[model samples]
Target: MCDQCISTVAASAGSRRRRLWDLPHQCHCPLVGVCFPLSTLRQLVNKALGGKAMADDYEVHVGAVSECLQRNRLSELLQKDLESRYASTVQAFRAAKTTKELAGLWADAVRRGDVAGAFWAALTHPRCDEVLQEVVLRDMHMLQHQAGAAIRVDIGKFNLLLREHGVLARELGKAQQRCTQLLAEKSAEIEQLNSQLVQQRAATIGKETRIAFLLQDLQQLRASLPDYENTSRLRKQLEQLAHRQAELETQNAQLRQQLGQAQRALSLRGPEDAPALASEPQQDPIKEAPITLHLGKKTVLCVGGRNGNLAHYREVIERAGGQFAHHDGGLENHQGALDAVLGAADLVICQTGCISHNAYWRVKDFCKRHGKQCVFVENPSTSSLSRSLQQIAQVP
Candidate 1:
């Protein structure tokens, strides 16, 4: 249509609610561009053209439809579709009772990016005027230019972000691989430490077992001496023998002189005196013998003594020809065995200083009940044990 024809149409419509075909030729481009997607506009134009093929160019299609100033098949369809699509915007515009209020609603719609519905609703609004149309057109023109510049900037930023993302992704993959390698190395080290710990524990247990066995063997060897108690006594006897040797030699000389005197007298007194001298017995100088204690094979039970002196205690009883038995007085040995050991013993010797009161009582009670001999020795020496045995031996 020509500008005069468009001017005449605008003059004919006098500010009543206008239709899409009644809008000025300039309003067509913004309304068509904002209100419809390209694909939708293409379909609508194709359908309106009665299957006539439209050009593929977007501008070609928009230009062809923009010249529809009078109502036709295409213009009528577009008007119906816009009114239907923006019914709520139209109702909101209708609520504005003045030209100023309607313009405010149009500005608000533009700010909210709802220009499609607002543009259709505002131009077709009953309060729409020439001045409001010119203002809205100018605003839409500036907005299109700003949108183009923003699009170009966004495309450049998006490309930069794409390259940065690739670099960051490669760094993240390398970091994860290094973390996995460190984890594997740490796991191997932990396994090695655990193996060494197991070996050290095994060696420690073996050493402990060997030490216990050796300690038991040592105790047995200490208790195995047959004559340990006689060592000191024998040393004293040897010293006494050395002192008596001089006395024995002097006596031998005096006895030989007496014998010579007796022989001279016997020769003077003749054969009768010889028979008397021959009948008398001669004395020896070294006549003493060593004394030893004998127990006559009795089972002597000694309870409680110093652990180091246990060998001496055993040797004392054994040297006296007595069978030796002992208990550690509920210290190292079990207390339960005290009663059984007490029952089997012929004589009970208790070392009170080294024994528990319970074991002492048990020994005392057993010996008292059975009427067996019991000796409570305060000292745990071998001499005390020897004296106890001698006291028992002299009991008749």
Candidate 2:
């Protein structure tokens, strides 16, 4: 027995010693000389021998026995407590101080069928508790670090996306500005084109109006103009007729005056001279011709006489007591003829149709330069020739 066992036995023996004083047997041993009931003696021996041996050599032996008895008593008490307070005892074991103590409690709870106490004992061991706490803390820190890294990565990606969007927006703005500039340029071009079209249309309308006016004037001129040859010939014939009529009138007037003078002379003469004039029947007044008076001769020259009709036209001039001359040639020869006629003739007539435009112009220019009368004649037929002869006789 140990000190705990000895102390328990000694307490029981002391209570019983007061009830029984004398022993029934006596022993020769000095350590234990008295003997009584076997149960009582054994109790007394346990009390006296426990922890009383204080030798250094017996110290371990004594501690062993005391520990054995204490464990036996603890096992019995725990068995009874486990049925009622098993949960509380398990919780208390979780707060145990050492790995050994926790293991012992766990074994006791298992033998007594305390399931909760066994679980707590396993988890609350000193080494297991430290390792579990370290593992849990390490995992939590890893998770926090991973979460922070993920957040940083997301932020970086968001910034990149924002930068790209900004670039795109700038490009889009530039494109829009270019489009606006192009549209403005196109609008200006369109306006210029429209203005040009308006100017062109106005010019076309003005041209059309001028053409219409010219056409109307041309139509009026065509409606009024006689044939060129006929007009020229008629003008010439009228001039000739007027000249012949004037000559006839002058002759008639002279004749009338002469008759009156002769009658006066016959009356003034004596009776004998009157009888002599009566023998001639008064000079036969009806049959007598009037005296013709001579005047200074006038000459007219005709140029460009291709048909050689100038001789026939001379009859009209001779009746008027005037002379006529002509020069026949091409334009160059005609120009020389014009110069000669200008020097010799009082009047010059140039036929125009036989010449080109340049020759006609030259002839007209020559006449104007010399201050000569020039008559232009186109084609002449027999009727036109007769009319031209009449006009020449009647020329003023």
| Highest lDDT scorer | 1
lDDT of 1 by residue, 271-380 (tens): 77677878999777874222255768889888897755666677777877889877768876668767877888888899999999998888888888899889999998
lDDT of 2: 0.51
lDDT of 2 by residue, 21-96 (tens): 1111110111011112234333333454553433442342333223322334422332233324345654566565
For candidate 2, which ten residues in a row score worst on lDDT? 18-27
On the 0 to 100 scale, the lDDT of residue 16 in model 1 is 65
The candidate that achieves the highest TM-score relative to the unseen native structure? 1
Quote the positional error of residue 345 for candidate 2 in Å. Answer: 28
For candidate 2, the per-residue lDDT at 231 reads: 53
Stretches of model 2 off by over 4 angstroms after superposition: 1-162, 228-304, 307-396
